[model samples]
Target: MTGNPAHRRWLMLAIGTGGQTAMTTVLYGLPSLLPAFQREFGLSLAGAGALVSGPILGILLTMVGWGLVADRRGERFALAAGLLPAAAVLSVAAAVRGATALAVLLVLAGACGASVNSASGRLVIGWFPPHRRGIAMGVRQASQPLGVGLAAAVLPPLAEHAGLPAALGCCALLCAAVGGVVLLLAVDPPRPPETGTVRGPGPYRGGRLWRLHGAAALLCVPQFVVAGFALVFLTTARGWPAATAGTVLAVANLAGAGVRLLAGWWSDRVGSRLRPMRLLALATAAAVLLLALGAAAAPPLGTAALLLATALTVSTNGLHNTAVAEHAGPAWAGRALGVHGLGQHAAIVLVPPLTGALVTAHGFAPAYALAAVFPVAAAALLPGEPAAPAGETAAPSLDAASAAPRTPA
Candidate 1:
């Protein structure tokens, strides 16, 4: 629609993907390096795991606030203000002695990280046309694992070669750089959110939205389960060194990032969202079972294949959100995404501790059995491609020349 659209489009994608990586790198980076944290801080395994849990808890509680602020203030200001300061706070935490102080910093990092997501999701939707959004959004979602993967690869040595505090301080600086780039370089979508107070189908008024939310919550179990404990699984169950587990986990994540890009791209081309989700569900289920069987067998190659397969299984990331945005429309997009995210985070918060206990008491098999329940539930909730209210077709549309893109960070 303008001069040199291709170049500008790539620019936007970079900003979208880069911003996501900056925010999520903080999240994924910590888990891979937990062993180092445990040794230095003299933490129990559970205590070290809380380092991962703290930020997630903050994100779970504050997602709505992040979305609302982005909607009101524009993303650039909101993200810049939150992310830059968050980095500073995290750096300060690195220096402090008490566990309480570190936990507070993690929570703050999470809350600030939450602020970045809504804005970024909206940006991707706005930048890429509807048909290709799956791939683009996939890339956007892939940023989480990509950030984690990079951190897994780089952070430990940076810490060991340098120092833990110094390593974390580097992450803080990266966040600052990304924040500044977003504020200075990223372009806002031209339009505001839709005019009506009623977004899509007035979610709370009906059962359908809740059904979708429940499904999303169920689907989130696998993601959180892997994220919280994948490294632990490799280290404890398979007898790999914790460091080796971290490296392999990063490899799996890199594969996952590729999958996300492809999945999102395919969604954009295919009008119907449920088909891919259905396929993903089946594949993901198989991966879970395969991993479980491998663990039961306790073989080396089987475990490796399962880990790699897990990456492949999760490739179709965030397709559910694409379906929602298409069906629900931008009016309700932010809150709707947040509401669904609330369900996902609900799973994130509960699954880890519950499954961790299950692993301790019953074993990984029981924990995975419980984990397998989520994708099945998510698949069941796909809203059967219904007829929209009168003339409504769920594909995203700009209401005006300045119509803004919807985000689900």
Candidate 2:
């Protein structure tokens, strides 16, 4: 931070994105080992579904609590404290014998990880100025997919050799180690201008915030639905091996990582997040529709469509985050971003159990059909213009504040 802000900006980006990559790889990386989980537990698909649902439900319950803490305490403390316990929780996840204990461990892990997202987003936004924040956040968004890619490439082999529990334990240790590094290396960015004690305009004052909220909720459905079911669909329906499904998911994550950067860069150069958001939503809608059609079609065609949809559906992640960041401003950015995150977590929490039920009853086709509508509905609801194009986002340099919000290192 003492050096030029621009140079420091890249450092902050690396830490924030790096932490996201690690946490997501550990948290959401379970699908790659579903077959073994089923075999070991002697469980049905529905019973195994909780492995995905547990963490999300924890996230659902705790994100806003983290937001409030971020607003009051600061991102650095929130992140450090959050990461410290992750090792223990994940250790429990590794050692737990019963399904109930595993679910409880996952729920604790998810709740702990929830703080990482809010604290991390604040960290990135704290570092970059408004104009360049898109690309910064986009790169930050890439961390999730990057983590997934790492999991895909590493987890299968690791699980094959050491067993899933030991692999998870390894991941937990890595997260704690990285968390310590971030706590030491990452610094909050300087705020640009001074913010007075005056109350700034807030999202709660108008309908705009509500609109974005609804849109995020809708847009999140397709992404989460695809995430929840993609591997299962490929494995169960296409008759592909579990390893092959893991490979496809890995590939899909790589594609998603690329799109995250493109989406952010487009927002940076094109001068708006909303327009690109619409295009992304439309593409996601088309992708989801094609995905549904592909499900019933040839295996190869279905695979291609599913991969395409996975990339597009997940691609909007950065755009949506940046849009929410731009709208929320520095004053309530923590809370706004927390609420926005809440939307994603809510979908993640609700969708898996529902998807499992859907798969159990009417089957996956209807599930995909229902999931495809979410992004379309999101696209339909998006305004031609984002709420705060520029005026409201004015923020003081992070260094100037009594409590500077540190980006997650």
Best by the lDDT measure: 2
Stretches of candidate 2 exceeding 4 Å from the true structure:
191-196, 386-409
lDDT of 1 by residue, 1-409 (tens): 3445545556667887787788776755677666677777887666676776777787888887776776666666766876888788778967877778888888888877877667777666656556566776787888877887777767766767777787678778888888888877777555453577654445455565676677667776776666667766777877887567667777878988888777777766766566777778767766776666666665564476557654755665567765555444544555666666667676676555566666767666666656666687778776665454567665433232233333321
lDDT (0 to 1) per candidate? 0.68, 0.74
Taking all chains together, the TM-score of candidate 2 against the true structure is: 0.90
Model 1 residue runs over 4 Å out of place are 1-6, 192-205, 388-409
| Cα lDDT tens digits for candidate 2, 1-409 | 3766667778878877877777786567765555566776887776777676777777777888887777667777777777768767888788877778888888888888888788788888777765677788889998887787677667766777788787778778867886897789777644435556766667566566667777888887887677767777887888887677777788888889999899988887877777888889988888887777776555677678878877887787777777776666666667877888887777666676678778878766677778888888887887666433366533222222322333432
- Choose the strongest candidate by TM-score: 2
Please state every model's RMSD to the true fold in angstroms.
Answer: 3.8, 3.8
Cα lDDT over the full model 1: 0.68
Candidate 1 weakest ten by summed lDDT = 400-409
Candidate 1 lands at a TM-score of: 0.88
